[model samples]
Every structure is written in C-alpha cells, then in structure tokens.
Target chain A: MGEGLRGSIETTGLTMIYRSGKVEVPAIREINLTVGPGEFVAIMGPSGCGKSTLLHLLGGLVRPTRGQVLIDGIDIAKLSDAERTAVRREKVGYIFQRFNLLPNISARANIELAKRIHGNGHANLYKDDHILALLGIKEKIGFRPTELSGGEQQRVAIARAVINQPSILLADEPTGNLDSHNSRLVLTLLQDLNQRLGQTIVMITHDSEAASMANHVIEMRDGRILARTHHFVYEPEFEGLF
Target chain B: MTHSLVAANILSRPTRTLISILAVGTGVILMLIIGGITTGTLNDYLNRTMSVGADFILQPSGSTVFYAFSSAALPIKLADKLRETPGVGAVAPVLAKFSSADFGLVFGIDLATYDQFPGRLEILEGRNSLQGNEVIVDDLYAMSHKVSPGMTVEILGRKFTISAICRRGSVVRVFVPLPTLQQMNGTEDKVTIMFIKAAPGADVESVFRELHRAYPGLALVRTTDPSVLLADTRMPGLKEFRLTVVTVSMLISFMVILLAMYTTIFERTREIGILKSMGASKAFIVGLILRESVIISLLGIAFGVGASLIIRKLITTAFPTLQVDMTFVEVLRGSLLGLLGGTLGALYPAYKAARMDPVQALSYE
Candidate 1:
C-alpha cells in the first residue's frame, strides 16, 4: 500500500533493563528488528520473554536503556521525554490485553479523548462514522467499558486507537482476555484494520492462531528473537510451548 | 469529553464527592461567618460612634476603640475643661458599661448636653425624658426585646422603666441618665469618655489638634473617619484574631482537598496509566486532575456562599442587636481563598499522577 511508506519501523541493538536498588534485570537485550510500512507482524513468545517490553519500546512507552527505535526514519530513543510523547501521540496507538478503556467514561468519550490527545493539527483521512462502522462499534460507543462484553470492549479500544489515524498500532495481546469466538472476531478486525488503513501493526500474542493473521511472525525467547517466519508453523523444535 | 470524564470521575463515588464538597463549603462558611461578625461588630460600633457628629473623642491614655473595655478613668469634670478649649463648642460626658446580657455597651449621657450634637436622640415614642431609673432604648433594641414605653426592664442589674424609644441610629442601644449610671457604678464623678463637637464654621482638624494638645496625657481620637477609627493599632489583637480565623479556615479546605485528591489519584492509578499509554503528556494529566479539583472547588464555593447568607440571616434574626456583615467583597475573598486552598491541595497528587510510569501503571492491578 502506498500509505505504508510513512509507517516503517526499525530498531538497532535495542535494550531495556529495569533496576530495583542495585539489582539490574534486563527485560530486553540487543534486539535488532525491522518492519516495512503497513506490515502486520506478530511476536510470539512465552511469558517473561520481553515481548511486551519490546512492544512498549516500539510505542515509546518507556525509554530504552540503550539502542535506537526508528519510526518513520526518526530515532525516538534519543528524543526527550516530551518529544517522545509527542511522537507517540502523533504516530502511535496502543491496545492493551485488558482493553485499557477509561472505565468512568463512555466508549465514545474514550475514542474522543485519543483524538484530543492527537490534537487538531492533522488532516484526518477517515471520518468517525466510517471508522466506527468499520469496527462495528457504532452502536456500542454509548456504554462504559464495564458494561460491554470483552469482544465489544476490544472493538471500542480498536476504535479509540485508530480514531486519530496514527501510523503505527501496537497491541499487547489485544485478544488475550476474549473467549475463542471473540478472539477470532478481534483478530479478523485487526487484520482488516491493517489491510484497509495501511497501518503498521505489531502485536504480541501466545496463541498461534492469532499469529496466523499477521504477514510476519517473530518468535522470542529470553528477550531474544529465536525465529522469524512469514507463515505460522508448529515446528517440532518449539515443543513444550506452555 | 475531558469535562465529561472529570464529571464522571466525581460522580462515580457520590459519597466521597459529597464529603469533599461539604468540607470545602464548611471552610468558606467559617471564614465568612466569623469574619463577618468581627467586621460587622467593629464597623457597627465605630459607625454608631461616628454618627453622634462628634469632631473628637477624649478617653484615658491607651484606650481602645471599644469604649466598654475602658474604665471610667476620665473624670466627669473633664467635660467643662474640654468645652472651654478653643474650637470646642460642646462637650458631652459619657459613662460606658459593658452589658453581658445584651452583648453590647450601655451608655450614660446627659440629655441636655448630648442633644447639643447633631445626631441627638430623637424620641419616637413616649416622653423624651431620661431621669433616675428611666432608660431610653433605641428602636432596634426595643423591637428585638419586645419592649416599649412604660415597660420595666432590668438593665445592668437594676430595674428601669423605658421612658422613650429613640430612632435606631443611636450611639448605643441602651441609654440611662448620666447621674443614675454613675451612682449605680459607684463612680459618681467618673466617666468613660467625652464626645466633643466643634463649633459651627470651626475647622474640625483645628479642633482635633487643639484637643490633642489640651489632653496630652489622655488619648484623643478623631471620630469623623471610620477607617482612622478602625485602624489596627487602635484595635489591639483585631488583626491577629482575623488572621488566625482565616488560617484555620484555609487549613480545613487545604487538608480536605489534599486528602481527597490524594486518595483519588491513587484510586485512579490505572486510569492515569491508560492516559499515558494513549500518549497523554504530563501537562495533560496534570490538567485533568486540576480541572476536576477546580470544578469541585467552584461547586463548594457556591455552596458555601449560599449557606453563609442563610446563616447570617439566622444570626441576625435570633440576635437582632448583633450585626454580621457579609459584603460582596468578603464573599469574593472567601471564595478565592477556598479555591486557592483546594488548588494547592491538588498539586502534589497531580504531580504524582503526571510522573507515573506508563509501563508499570498499565501492568498495575
């Protein structure tokens, strides 16, 4: 897609280490990865494998202890905290495993809040009705997150994420809290969004079925990439995958 | 949408919101009511004193604005000496006594000498005679106590028949003959103060200066100006008392808002994380929290101002002799102080919320 050219992401030797007192623990270490514009990439890994930390770094949610995170050719790791926040506001949208909808406000308010954070400078490519209808949450936007089912809440969260038409979408197990049927619904919706909007998508998931929807899948272990594949495969070497 | 979020946050926990609002409102009320009473009593006393059209007042050295606080140290013979001074036309000797039962001062004055001033007591009912054991009550005092002409009232522990009801704007609500109050007080030749009036076409400033020169050992006060009369130096402990009341009132608002907003931010830790994850800046987060507090403060101010008005009405209705003034300026000052306290209280919590880590916050249970 021609729009994908502006959403490319690349990282060089990215690292994140969390410290408590004098004890330093590396969450992610020496990670080199790249995704072309509009690429739907899924990261598959076991728990504590730094999949979420990598996603957080990509979204500018945390400052990396070392290395470079390039979004649209601009390195965010070197930017100041405020500057990084501006970049995140203008170019990235995040979806959490729990949906992360502000529970006190209506779904519509949640979506509107993102637009407010993005500001009024950008010329939006899609209207609210088109996005809401595409995500099939136009009728559910009046309810608070607690009142909606898990799948409905995820749909609302997707609408909130894309309402500003950001260039990058980062999902930390977007369907982790959904049932099997809702999981398929959310995955198909993410696939549709990536394809229709030409937005680069980076998602972390344990379910292989969720990974199959992405154009590229990267498997991670101990904060390092163990395999990169174009299609989902239950390989023999990756046994005992609990 | 931001406003709705703030409103929803405040409305979600109705009980806590109500308690916070009430606390802030109570602070404003305390400020307005106590402050109103202090100012009202002071102004009322000073204004009534000035109403007598006296150019100057002579009292014992180091006397306060409250004449009741001063003993009868100025001799009644000082009236003749003051009257003989240059530019002094009339000198009225007044013996003032504090009446605990009335919560005011009782004044003893000679009817003939007091009438020489411009603000003479004009009789509205009964006879214009104040003699032995006969009291003259102002219209306000009469109405408040349901007393009228021919009614016997116990004043200063002595029975007195109401000889007349004067107009409301008098120097004191209760008045007795100068000789009678002096005899009862056991200070037959002593007086509390002397109200001196300048002759017609006489310069008041010259009279004031002459009085000051003539009574070098006594305190000479100009009675024409209210501000000069109510100066802090003349009213000992008045400024400090007002400041103490204001400080206590503001502390209530500050503490309530600090605890409320502090608890609120902790409860909304996850929501703050969500905002940060949505790319909200520190300023945006702080703005959200401040906006909520300002709204709460505004609501509390409105509640406070309304309640203060009602309380003022109740106080005056119950105690007609007492005055509590809640002027527009006082109301505005109270509102602004309450707002300031609340805004200050929210600062720490807002800072904490703004500095929250999105990663840790998102993962928080």
Candidate 2:
C-alpha cells in the first residue's frame, strides 16, 4: 500500500430516502461501513438492494438524507453541491457498467476529459505510450467508442478513470455487460491496478466469483449490510525437514 | 476545445442555422427596400414642390383675397425701381392672367429677362421668342391639348402660337409676351409681380426692407425661401398618410422577425443544450447565434441595396422627371436598420440560450 492508503472512507449511520408526494420510501437505511484505501472491495447485492445508491453517495454524485460520508477525515456532506462535484471530479473517478464514453470523441479524448475537468496542467500527461501499453489498447487510441468492441470500450473507460490518478475509484458493475472471458480480463486489469499502483477500487457486482477476487466482499440486502468477509490469500511453501 | 473549432461546430448544422438566418435576412431586406422607396419619393416630392429660385412674389396685401383674384396690381415701372434698390441684382416684370377654361394661371413674362428664374421650364421646341403674340406652353398642357409648337390657341380672346413645350407636370405654365398680355388686359404700364434677385451673401431681409420701402403698394412676399413656400402650402394629409404606411409596414416586419427568431430558438433547443453541455459559456453561445444572425442580415441588406439601385435606375430611365438620389447616408440608414432588426430579433433567443442549465440541457435528448 502507498503512504496515502493509511486513510480510508467511512460512512456513519447513512440513510437515503426518496419522496414522491405524500409517500416516503427508503433506498438505504442506517448503513455503516469502512473501506481502506488501496483495498479492492466488491459490493454484492440483488436488484433494489441500493448498491448503486450507496456508490452514488460515496462518490458524492447524490446527497444523503442523513449521516455523513468521510473521506480522509473530511466530511463530504458538509460541502456544497458544486464543491462536492469538484471533490468528486478531483478525487473520485467512476467507471460505469455501460462504458459511458462520449461517442463523438476518440478513445484518447475520453481520457483527456478527466484532466480537463480537474484543471490539470498537462492534458497529455496520461497520453504516454506506457499507459496505453499497460492497458493493451495502444493501437486503439485514435478509434472512437463506436468503432471499438464492448471490451475495448470498457478498457478505455477504465483508462479514463485512472488517468487522473484519483485516490478512490467507484465502479458500478464494471464488467456486468461483458462475456466471461472479457469479464475476467476486466477483473484481472482491476486487480493488477490495485496491486501495482496501490489504487483503491470499490466495485458493485452480482457475481460471487467476481466478488471473491476482492480483498474484502460486502453483501447487502434491503439497503442494509448483511455480511462482510475479509480474506487474504496465503502462499504455501515446502519444508525440507518434513 | 478551441474557439475556432467551436464556431465551426456551431456553424456546421447549415440547414437549420441557414433557415433561421434567412428569416432574419428576409425581414431586413423588406425593411430596406420599403424605406428606400419611401425616402426617395419624399425627397423628390419636396424638391419639386418647393421651387426656391424666384426671389420674391408680389401680391396685394390686406384687401386682396388671392393672387389671381386681386384687382390691384403692380405697375411695370416698379420693376425698374426695384432694380435700382440696394442689393437687388435683377428684376423681371411679370403680367399675371387667368384662363377660366383651363383653371390655370398664366404669367406673361419678359422672354429677355425670364432666364433669371426659369422654374424648371426647359424649352424643347422653338426659341424663347416673345414675338407676334407667341406663347410657350408646358409639355403637359401641350400633350393634353394636342397642340404642336406652331399651333395657335386663343386665350382670353387673344390669338397666340405655342412657341415651345416646357417641362412636364401638373403645374403646367404658359409664358406669353408682356406687351401682348398688356394689350389683352387693355391696360398700359401695368404688371402683376416683379421677380427679383439679390447678390450672393446679400441679406435678403435688408433687401426686402429696401424693396418694401421703394414699392409700398406691393407686398414683399418672400417665396424664394424654401421653408416658407413649403409651410404656406398645406399637403392635404399626404405626409401623415405616408408616415402611417411606413410605420405599419415596419411594425409588421418587426413582428415577422420576432416570430421567426422565436421559432428558430425553440427548434434548436437540442443543439443549444448540446453546446452548453460541451462547456460553452452563456456569453459564447449567445455571441455565436447573434453573429450568425447579423451576418445573414447584412448579406440581405447588401442584396436589398443592390436591387434598389437597379430599380432606381429603371424608374429614373422610365420617367425622367422623377429625380431619385440614393445617397450614401440613406443606404447607411437602411443597413443600420437591418442590423437593428437582427439584434432585436435575436434578443429573446439569446436570453433563452444563455439561461440553459448544463445538466438539464445534456439530458434533454
């Protein structure tokens, strides 16, 4: 883990309620959770489990009805909407399941958007051959999103998310639309990024196999955390005396 | 990403944008053509009606009802006396007579001295000779009466030959010899009015005072001043009618432009939203739309001005009497009016475009 990984994100008694006229429906209720920086965490839940809603709150895309979202000891709920958006733009990068890349711009331009939004000095800082070579998409930089395959588009989306070198990455079903092979490829890319760059990743997925790859797996039912399993893979070595 | 690219993108949707621009352009063209025609006619009418060459008009003062009805008249000796007055340059004695059959006034003037104030009368036939009871008739009167240059016409029981045809129009005048008019009126040393001229830079007021002192019996009516002549003649509500027509036309044109611009903005809502989502500022969007509108309007203005020039030439050639002077200032006024119409038309659309919210706009599809 990097030195910055000492701090993590925490949600304290978070509650989100949707109001329609006189009716009040709860999307999430009294959720408490902690995600360590640089840790690959997967949130698993069925539909209507508020997995995406929770991700939205953590990313500051939506405001919570109550409680606080803390990132590195700072409360995001206390900030204004514009300020929250700025914080999210600068600190959190999102990779959507559908690969929400602007259709008109090329693959390289998709990554350029993040740098422009964050007011970075170097627009082409991430346009280096190494980043494209790392993603195995160096040859497809000039291709538009429509020209690329589904897996290629997702790789570009991932590249766009990491181009800013954000402290935390929030992805909603990053591989939900892909085949098994493409899904494995995307997952391996996420795992490799976590191990090599110490990049934090919080992903929402339905597949248990995908969840098993994470350092921590969180399951939710009815907007409440049902179970959390922390696992560390251990490598076994042979003893010569034995 | 760059201003040029952004502008190019905004202009790339040629069909939709051109339609909006054409709406503005059509309105501007209509305004320019109508304004040009009306201004040209008004100027010509003013120049024609107000003849300022005649320095003075002699009329009876208090008891005299009109110049034609007056029994009192100025003697011919007053012309010689007015010539000797200070600042008086030249004096031409005129004998005024009326022809009841034509309801027109005749000024039997001295052919030798009539060159001082000809009053747009260009002799197209025989010379300006006042010999043998000959008369010069305006072209309008000659054409109406079917009288040629050598034809004889009896007026007030005196036989006279039409020596020449003067310029055309309803203010058709006939010039008979002064001695023949005296013989017809059966009076000697009798004249109607003395037309006078003053040297350049000579104050007409001082000249008028001296003329009035010299000829106390004659009224020193200063008809030479353009403003006084125009003021004295009532225009029979023609100006009001013209103003009403022009104002209503402009109002209709303005309404058309307003509606066109409104429709254009409403139709381009998606495009505007896309631009806003692309991080274009409110001012930038407004400026782009306004620039497009203004450019189209100016093009239309140029076309209208060019067309008007051709029309003016055609009209002038067809009717030589109609003097149409399309001045630079008038063309400038038309162009500026076009620009104003374009700006006014784009105001509402620009405001709507500027106030669009980026998020709502992006999701408008």
TM-score for each candidate, following the candidate numbering: 0.95, 0.57
Give candidate 2 regions above 4 Å deviation: A1-8, A121-129, A195-198, A231-242, B2-15, B27-199, B204-365
Per-residue lDDT of candidate 1, residues B206-285 (tens digit): 88887787678998888987887888778999999989988888888888888999999989989998998888999999
lDDT tens digits by residue: candidate 2, B319-361: 5444566678766765676667666776777777767654344
Model 1 TM-score is 0.95
lDDT of 2 at B319: 50
Where does the lowest 10-residue lDDT sum fall in candidate 2 chain B? B1-10
Q: Report how far residue A130 has shifted in candidate 2, in Å.
A: 3.9
Model 1 lDDT per residue over A1-242, tens place: 24445788999999999999999999999999999889999999899999999999999988999999999988999998888899899889898899989998999889988888778423354588899999888899999999999999999999999888889999999989999899999999999999999899999998778888899999999899988999676454554463
Off by over 4 Å in 1: A1-5, A121-126, A233-242
Whole-model Cα lDDT per candidate?
A: 0.90, 0.68
